[model samples]
Target: MAEVKLKNLTKRWGDFVGVDNQSLNIKDQEFLVLLGPSGCGKTTTMRMIAGLEDPTGGEIWIGDRKVNDDLPKDRDVAMVFQNYGLYPHMTIFDNIAYPLKVRGTPKDETRPRVEKAAEQVELTQFLDRKPKALSGGQRQRVALARAIVRTPKVFLMDEPLSNLDAKLRVTMRAELKHLSRALQITTVYVTHDQIEAMTLADRVAVMKHGIIQQLGTPDEIYNDPANLFVAGFIGSPAMNLINGSVRDGMFVTTGGTRLTKLPTADRARAILGVRADDMSVHEAGQGDIDVTIYAFENTGESTLLTVQWGKQRVIARGDRHLRKEQDDVVGISLDPDHLYLFDPDTEQRIRM
Candidate 1:
């Protein structure tokens, strides 16, 4: 187990900067996730740490040594790519044993290590089969077992679960989480999927345009976003951002409806943010504001109501059994304790 550190790390192609100067410290045995949309430089940052890509400027340190000049093999880290890079002709046992073989572990020492790694990932039953016979999830486990077969100092996984189907991804996520906890290895995971980051990370670094926008635990990133982009990015339905202004301590929507009271001073422009689960739905005129429902969706677990608030629409997660239809009028109320205010011009959060 080791701590991974990036100090003023950067990557650039001519004028295009893939990773702007960024610095982060991932603790020993910590599961850190780099999360953002595509082209946000999360993968680039991980590549630098893995020795797959060199930094344009800055340092990459793993454990007590500076690994900026080391080759990938010398860096002592295992990587699991998105494609589950397994050899087609090798049996499951051979695939898992490749790392140990390359490093020249004795023939007698190899079998038990491979078997132990396979057992950790629950692949013991299929060791005799080849990669072609295994399902996608099983193939992913093989890749994982291969990585763990060597006990490298650090583990770098770049969207390792992205190729699997949705259900498979969830199952693999649990397996990955369990494995990480049991192994206690430092891991840096890259993914654009918010759900993945929220579920697997001990700490999440939300990035954009090659810059880390916010670094926090799941709860902090979800409940206490540092900026408009983070508040809008981390949630499933995302936080509903409504354009408006603050006047005399009251937040007024663009359509002239005073939505809620703000403790801050009056401002000409502001943005109101509230999550779907934070807002409640009710009969027309029963809650804070009455609006016509534009669309109603039943997602089995819960119902979602997209209601019109002036020219803007806000989605509210309703009880699963609650029924509503398009154009139906329903009252919407914001959870004052859960509300967020942001400065429109700066796109930064405002202290409540």
Candidate 2:
């Protein structure tokens, strides 16, 4: 395994730039995820690294050698794609052994390697079955087994679990994490799903419009986002961004309601971002402010109360047993330590 370095790398198709001039160093044995929605250049960047797509400019170095001219096979990177990319005609054992066979490994040596890889991914029992006979998750494991059959310099996964069901995705995520650690291979994973990126990556590079918004550990990106785009893009239900102003250490809503006291200085206009989990729901008049519940949801693990705060609806997480009607009044308390202030004009974090 080796580190991947992109030096001012770029990709373009006529007028549209898929990847801007960006440089990133993926440490050896690091699991780096390029995360964003579609058209954000995450896949394109991975394709370039795999030699599947030629970059419009800049250089790519895998360890000490520049690999811009190397073909996908010569780059020595194994890719597990979303579709599983298995050969329907071949059995699972053959599929796992294909890479080694193509490279002309001795017949005796190839068999043990194929069996070991299959065993590693828990596919030893399915070796005799064809791709068409296997389930989606099983087929994805075959793809993974195929990739691991060879000790490549880098491993690139393009949303390998996206084709599975939600429950299976979670299961496969755990399997992927286990396999990655056990193999200790340099990996670059691309995905539109924030949950996957947050769960699997050693570090995540959040992308938007072909430019990387921020790159950091999952905790850093979640707790200390760089800007509005990152804060809104990284969460599940998304962070509540309330339009307001900061005056004398207080965040005032547009409707003249004093929501909470901010630690930052006065600002004419600011976006107050608070996650639902960061705000506690309490009985009426028991917390910072009272608001009418717009909607109530019980998600098994917890309850969500969408409350009307001056025309804006803010979601506050309640205990699993907490019950309230749509018209019921409740108190919401914002955790000032977790609240974030962003500049409306610049769309950047205030960092106060």
Candidate 3:
């Protein structure tokens, strides 16, 4: 395993800058994920590290050696792409053994290593199957097995599960996490799916517009986002960003609802951030705000409630069994400790 580091890494295509000056340190054996929406420079960043794309500026280091000028094959890294790039004519065993063969490993030694990798990915039974014969998930497993067989210093995956069905994707997610832990390879995975990043990464780098907005563990990024963008982006229902003003140590929404009375310390902030899960619903009179329920979506264990206070809508998550219907008047309570404050001018987080 090797530690990978990127210092002021940047990439551009003509007038458009795909990746801005971005720097990151990935520790040895760490699972780091690059997460953001489409056109956010995530794949561009990954391609640079994999040597598929050259950076216009900055340096890349694998372990202690600067690898910015190194060829992809010489970088000692294995990459698994989204499309599961397998040779259609080759059998699963031959596909897995191709890297070892290209590197000139003895034929006797290559067989056991290929079989071992296939076993690790539960593809040992299908060793003789061609890419045409395997299912989508199985083809991906072959790709993964091929990457694993190389035993490279670092593993880079760019949304390798995107093509799989939902159920298969979940299974592969768990398998990939386990395989990474077992192999202890330094991994850098890129994806736009927040759930994949949250579940698979030891640390996640949330990016937007070619820049990292936040870098933290799943819980930290979800519970304490660094800015309004992050708070609004990382969650399922997303965080509720109510437009309210602080006046006389209290928070008041535009519709005459007093949601929270902040401490002197928190009162100075201009905006508040609250997560959907942190807010609870009740009858209109007892809580801080009266909202007309716009909709309620039942999501297995919990229900996502969309409530409108005047013209603005906010979501709150609660137990699915707790029933509330459309157009029902409900009271909403905001948990102050869970609330995040942001500066209106900078759109950055403000300490309470």
- Give Cα-based local distance difference scores for all models: 0.94, 0.94, 0.89
Clash counts for the predictions, in order: 0, 0, 0
Candidates 2 and 3 compared: the better one by TM-score is 2
TM-score per model over all chains? 0.98, 0.98, 0.96
Can you write out model 3's per-residue Cα lDDT over 41-90, one digit (the tens) per residue?
Answer: 99999998889999999999999989999999899999898999999999
Which residue pairs collide in model 2, if any? none
Task: Give the Å shift of residue 11 in candidate 2.
Answer: 1.1
What TM-score does candidate 3 reach?
0.96
lDDT of 1: 0.94
The runs of at least 3 residues in candidate 2 whose Cα sits more than 4 Å from the true structure, single-residue gaps closed, are none
lDDT tens readout by residue for model 2, 1-352? 8999999999999999999998999999999999998999999999999999999999999988899999988999999998988999999999999999999999999999999999999999999999999999999999999999999999999999999999999999999999999999999999989999999999999998889999999999999999999999998779999999999899999998999988888989999999999999889999999999999999999998898999798888899999889999988899989999999999999988
What lDDT, from 0 to 1, does candidate 3 have? 0.89
Candidate 1, residues 116-195, lDDT tens digits: the string is: 99999999999999999999999999999999999899999999999999998998999999999999999999999999
TM-score of 1: 0.98
